[model samples]
Target: MASLAGCLTGEEESENTLEVLHGWTGGDGAEAADALFSAFEEEHSDVDLNNKPIGGGGNENLDQTVSTRLNSGDPPSAFAGWPGSNLEQYDGVLGDIQSDVWEEAGLEDAHVEEAVEACQFDDGYSAVPIGSHRMNDLFYNVGVLEDAGVDPESLDDVDALIDALGTIESETDATPLAMSLEAWAILQTWTVVMLSTQGYDAYMSFIEGDGDESAVRDTFETLEELLSNYINDDAASVGFTEVNQDIMSGDAAFIHEGNWVAGAYINEDLEYGEEWDAIRYPGTEDMYGLHIDSFIYPGDNPSPEATATFLRFAGGETAQVAFNQYKGSIPTRSDVSTEEFNDYLTETIEDFEAASEKPPTLAHGLAVDQSTQSSLEDVLNNNFADPFDVDAATAGFMDAI
Candidate 1:
C-alpha cells in the first residue's frame, strides 16, 4: 500500500495530474481504490493521480459532496457515479468517454454487455464502469443459522424467511434481522420487498409509473411487518456498518445489503461460506438487482488527456480485476475470470449471468432521477419512523414519481 504522498510526488512532477473524486474511503473499498490508482500511477509514471475520497457516508453523501463541488465550480477532473437516471443529471457536464476512452481500452468486447449499456445515456456513453454489484444480496452468519437449526438453502421466499426468523428469535438471542435506519438503507430493504412480493415486471412498472396499486400496497405492508417483527430494536440508532457488526458477532442472523458486505467481511479476514454466506434476497432469484460504480469526466476538467487515460485504465482488465477483487464486486467485464475471487464472488458471477431479468436498484441511484429518489426517500423515512400505513405510504410513493 502506497501513501497518498507517494501517489502525488515524484522527482519530476508529472506533466498532468488527474484529480478523481469518489466515495470508496473505508474498508476494502478504500484499499481497492488505492491499489487501482497506485497501479495506474506506476504504469503512467509521467502522470500524477490525485485521488480524492469523500468519506462521510455512502452514495447519498458522496452525491451531495460532488453536487457541492460542481455547484461551487470546483469539480474534479473525474468522479465516480452510477449509471441510468443518475448519470442523466450530469449530462452536459459528463464526457462521452465511449469514443475516446472505451475504445482505447478495448472495453466494448471485454465488459459485460448489460454493464456497458447501463453506462450509456441518450446522448452517448457517459461513464466507464469498473464493477457490478448485486444489490439484492441477503447475507447471514453461518454459525447463527446453524445454531438456530435453520437450513440456509431451504429459505427461499418471504414466508420461509419469516419462519426462519422466528426460529432464530425463539432458539437464539440473536436479532432475527439486522438493518439500518439510514434513508437509503431503508429504501433498499423496501425495494427488495417490493420486488419480491410484486414480481419483477410489476416492480419495474410501478417505479416507472404504471403498475398494480394493490400489489404496491401489499409490498409496503409486508415490508412494514417484516421490519416491525424481525429487525433489531436498536436499528434506528445504527448504520449499516453497525448492522454488519451485529451479523459478524452473531448478535444478528441476517442482513439484506449489497455485495459490499462481502468486502467488509473479507477485510476482517472472515471466510466466505464459513463465517458468512450470501444468497439472493428472497423471491429475487430470477432477478438481478444491479448497482454499478463508474467514473465520468466532468466537462470542466483541466486535463482531458490525463482524465481520459484514467478512465481508460479504470475500464481495462488489469484495473477492473484488481479493484473489484478487493472491492468484493464482480468485474464489469464479462471476459474477466473469477479465479482470483473468493467462492462468494464466483457464486455471484454465476447468479449475475443466470438471472432472467436485471433491474436497476433505486437505493443506489439507478432506477430513478434524483428528485424522484429524494421524494421517495422522504416517504420511506417517514414510514420507517411511524407505524406502517399501506394506503398512506403507497400514495406517497405514487406522488413521489
Candidate 2:
C-alpha cells in the first residue's frame, strides 16, 4: 500500500523519469507488461512512466540489456529477471531487498524459499520473487483425449502418458504434441525429461560438474532418445509461432509450453477444462511445474526511491493480482487466489500445491549461469535443429561453457 510516488518531489515527479525496458511485445506478454505499468501509474500519478518493450517473440534478453546498462552506468531502476545461482554475477551490483517486506507479503513459503536460494548471491541478497509461470507443462485437448479413449486424469506415470500419446496419435490425424524449435522451449522439454528421470540430485551434479565426460555423455544420449521417441515429424524444424498456431487450432493435441499458453487459449476464446487442460509433464512425479520469474534490483542502483517503489508495487497484493491475472501466471503471494482461472487452471494449481514440498527443479533456461546458458542454448539449437555429431556436440557444449 506504500506508494513510491510519495518519495519524489516537484519537477521530477511529473518528469516521466523511469524508462522500463522489457521484452513484452504483442500478445499476452504485452498485456501483462502493460498491466504492471498501469498499476504503477495508478499509484504514482505524477511519475512519468515510459514503457520501452524490447524484442518480440520473447526475444527480449534482459541479461544482455542489464549488462550493457550496468557497465554504462545507466541501469534501469528495476529490470525483469529470474533467479538462479548465476545471480551471483551481480555480486556487489545487486541490492538486498527488505526481507520484512517479502515476508509480510506472504512469500516465504517453501517454493519461495527454493526460488530465493536459487537467486541468492554470495552476499545473501537476491532478486525478489514477482510471479511464476510454470513451463514444460503438457497442455492437451480434453476432447481429443476422450475421443482417443485416453483418460486425461489417468496419466499418473510416464509409461501411461506415453501410451496415451500413441493412442491420440493413432486415433486422430493431428500431431500428438505441438513443440517448437525455440531453443529455450526445446531445452525446457529436455530439462523436464532429465529432471523427471534423474531427479534433482543428478541434474545438479551434472550441471555443477566441471564438464565431466561421462555425465555429458549420458545427457546427450538421453537427449537423442527423447527426440527420437516422443517428438514427431521433424519437430526440430518448427518455430515458436508455428507451434502455438498448431496448438490454437486442432492440428495438435498437446503442446509442452509454459503458463503463457493460457493467454493463447484465451485469445482463441477457448475455455479451460472444457476445451483444454494442462497436466504436469510425465516423468515428473516428484517435481511439479513450478518456475520463478522476478525482477532484480541492482545493488549500486542510484535511484533508490524508484527501485523501492518498483519492488513494493510489484510484490503488493494488488499488483500481484493484476500482473498474474493478465500474464496467466501464479501469484507469488500465497494469500492470493486463482479464482479468476477456469477449471483447468484450478487443476494445474492443485497439482502445484500438492507438489509444493518437492523443491522446484529450475527450468533449464534459468537454472544455469549466464556463461553456461549461451553454451547450452547453442547445444539445444544445434542438436534439435540439425543432425549434428552428438559426441562432438556434447563435448563442444561442455567445452564452450
Candidate 3:
C-alpha cells in the first residue's frame, strides 16, 4: 500500500496522497473500512492513502470533524458519507465525478434502483455507493428475550413493545432496552419511533417538513416513557459503542440500531438466531429505512487521480463485498452476490427486496439537509434526552425541519 499525499511530511512530496476520511474508527467497523482501504491500496499501489477515522455514534463525531476541516479549507480527497438529499448541503463544493468514477465503475447498470437518485448532484454524481443499511432494526439478545418470555414477532407496535420492555424488567435483571443518549442516536431513535407511531406516509411527510405536531409530540412522549423506565440507569453516561455491546454481555436485552451493529454480535461469537438476532423495528415491517454511506468527492480535492481511483474501487464488487461482509450491510450493486455474507445480512437483503417502500433515513442525513439534521441534533441533545422534555423537544423538532 502506498502513502497518500493529502497530508504529508517534507520527504513525501513526490507521492500522490489521498487522505480519505471516515467514521469507522473502532470494532468491526474499523475492520470493514480497512478491507475497502486495503483493496483500494492494492489496486492503486502508486498512490499514498491517508486514513482518517472519527469515532462516535455513527457520524455523530465524524460530521463535526469534517465540517471543521472544510471550514479551515482542508477537505479530504474523499470522505465516507451518505448520498441522496444530504448532498444538497455541499452543492457547489462537490465535484462531478460521473465521468471518471461513475462511468469507470459502470454503476448505472449494476447498482440498485435506489442508488440512482441518491448519488445525483449538479447534473452528475457526487459520491459512490458502497453499501446500503436498513436503519430501522432492533437487535435483541436471544437468551435475554427467552428468559423474559417475550416473542419478537408478537411485539408489532409501540404499545406492545413497551409492554415487552416492562415484562423484561419485571422478569429479569437485564436492562430492558439498551440506549445511547447521544444526540445522533437519540434523534435516530426518535425518528424510528415517529415511523412506528404514524406509519410511512406520515414519516415521509415529517422529514419533508410537512409533519403533524401531534405526531411529533406523540413520538416524544413514547421516547420519554422508554428512556425513563425501560433502559439502564447509566444510559446517559454510556456511549453507543458500549451500550451496543451490552446485549452480548447480558446487561441489556434490546437495542434499536441499524444493521451495522450486527457485525459486533458476530464478532462476539454470537450466532445469528441462537445467541443474538435482529427483528424489524416495530411498525417498520412495511418499510425499509435506507442508510446509504458513500464517499464524497470534494470539488477542490487535492489528490484528484487518487480520489478517482479510490471512488472507482469503492463502487466495484470487490470493495463492496469485502466491506459489507464485516460492515453488516449489503452491497449497493445489484449484481454483487451475497453468498459470503452472514445469515443476518442475507435476510436483510431479502427484506430490502420485499419491502413495500424504502425511504431515506432522517437521523443520518438521508432524509433532510445539513441544517435540519444539525438543528434536530442540537435540540435533542440540549433539551430532550436527559430531561425527556416532550413538549419542548416536539417544538424544536417541528421548527428544525
Candidate 4:
C-alpha cells in the first residue's frame, strides 16, 4: 500500500502539470490511486501529476465537489467518477477520449465490452473505466456468524436473512447489521431490498418512472423494518468505515455494502473467506448491481496531452491490475487475468460474468441523473431520520423521479 501524504513531488515549475482529482482518501482506494499516480509519474518524469483527493462519506460529496469545480470553470485536468448518465451532466465540458486515449491504448479490443459501453455516450466515450465493483454484497464477520450458530449459506432470501438477523440479535451481543446514516448508504441497502423483493426488472421499471405501486410501498416498508429493527443502534451516527470497524471488532455481524469493504479488510490483513465472507445481497443472486469507478477528462483542461497520457495509463492493463488489486474491484479490461486477485474478487468476477441481469446501482449514480439522485437521497434520508409512513414515502419517491 502506498501513502498519499508524500506521493506528489516534482519540479515546482514543471512544464506540464496534470491536476487529477478523485475521491479516494484512505485505505486501499487511496493506496491504489497513489500507486497508479506514482507509477505514472515515474514513467513520465517531466509531467507533474497533481493528484487531489477529495474525501467524503462516499460519492455523494465527491460528486458535488467535482461538479462545483467543473461548473465554476476551474475543473482539474481529469477526475475520477462514475460512468453513464452521471457523466452526462458534464457532457458540455467533458472531452470525448475514446479515440485519443482508449483507442490509442487499444482498450476498445482489450477492455470488457460492457465497461467500454459504460464509458460511451451518444457521441463518444466520456470517461475511462478503471474497474468494476459489485454493489450488491453482504459482507459478514465469520467469527460472529459462527458464534451465533448461523450458517450464512442457508440464508438465501429476505425471510431467511431476517431470521438470521433475529438469531444473531438473540444468541449474541453483536449488532445484526452494520450501516451508515448517509443517504447513499441507506439507499444501497434499500435498493438491494427492492431488487430482492421486486426482482430486477420491476426495480428498473420503477427507476424508469413506471412500476407497481405495491412493490414500491413494500420496498419502503422493508427499509423501515430493517432500520427500525435489525441494524445497529448507532447506525445513524456511524460511517461505512466505522461500521467496518464494528464488524472487525465483533460488535457487528454483517454489513450491506459494496465490495470495496473487501479492500479495507485486506488492508487490515484479514483473510478473505476466513475472517470475512461475502454473499450476494439477499434475493439478488440472479442480479448484478454494477458500480464503475472511472476517470473523465474535463474539456477545459489546459494540459490535454498530459491528461490524455495519464488517462491512457489509467486504462492500461498494468495500471488497472495495480489499482483494482488493492481497491477490491476487478479490472474493467477483460485482458487482465484474475490470477492476481484474491478469492473474493475472483468470485465477484465470476458472478459478474454469469449474472443474468445486470443493473446500474441507484446509490452510485448509475440509474439517475444528479438532480434526481439528490432528490431521491433527500427522500430516503428524511424517511430514515424519522420512520415515515410507507404510502407517504412512496408518494415522495415517485415525485422525486
The per-prediction tally of clashing pairs is 0, 4, 9, 0
Write one digit per residue (lDDT tens) for candidate 2, span 84-136: 75565666677776563354444445234555565566555446666777765
Query: Over 4 Å off in model 1, which ranges?
Result: 1-15
**Candidate 2 global TM-score:** 0.82
Model 1: per-residue Cα lDDT over 181-293, one tens digit each: 77788788888988887888888898788867788788888887888899988877777887889888989999998888888897788988888998788899888899888
Each prediction's Cα lDDT score? 0.83, 0.65, 0.85, 0.83
User: Candidate 1's error at 181, in angstroms?
Assistant: 1.3
lDDT of 1 at 73: 78
> Which candidate should be chosen as best, given lDDT against the real structure?
3
Worst 10-residue lDDT window for candidate 1 reads 6-15
Q: Locate the minimum summed-lDDT window of 10 residues in model 3.
A: 6-15
Lowest-scoring 10 consecutive residues by lDDT in candidate 2? 356-365
Taking every candidate in turn, the Cα RMSD to the unseen true structure, in Å, is 3.5, 4.4, 2.9, 4.1
lDDT of 2 at 167: 85
Judged by whole-model lDDT over C-alpha atoms, candidate 3 comes out at 0.85
TM-score of 3: 0.94
- Residue 265 alpha-carbon offset, candidate 2, angstroms: 1.9
- Colliding residue pairs in candidate 4: none
| lDDT, candidate 4, 1-401, per-residue tens | 66432454443333267888888888658888877787788888877778889888776567788889888988788888888777767768887787889788888888877788778875788788899888888999999999999999998888899999999999999999987878888777878999998899888998898867889889988878877888877877878888888887889999988888888887788988788988888888888898888998788676788888988888988788788888988888877788778888888888887989888888877888777888888887766555656777788788887
Q: Is candidate 3 or candidate 4 better by lDDT?
A: 3
Evaluate candidate 1 by giving its C-alpha RMSD to the native, one decimal. 3.5
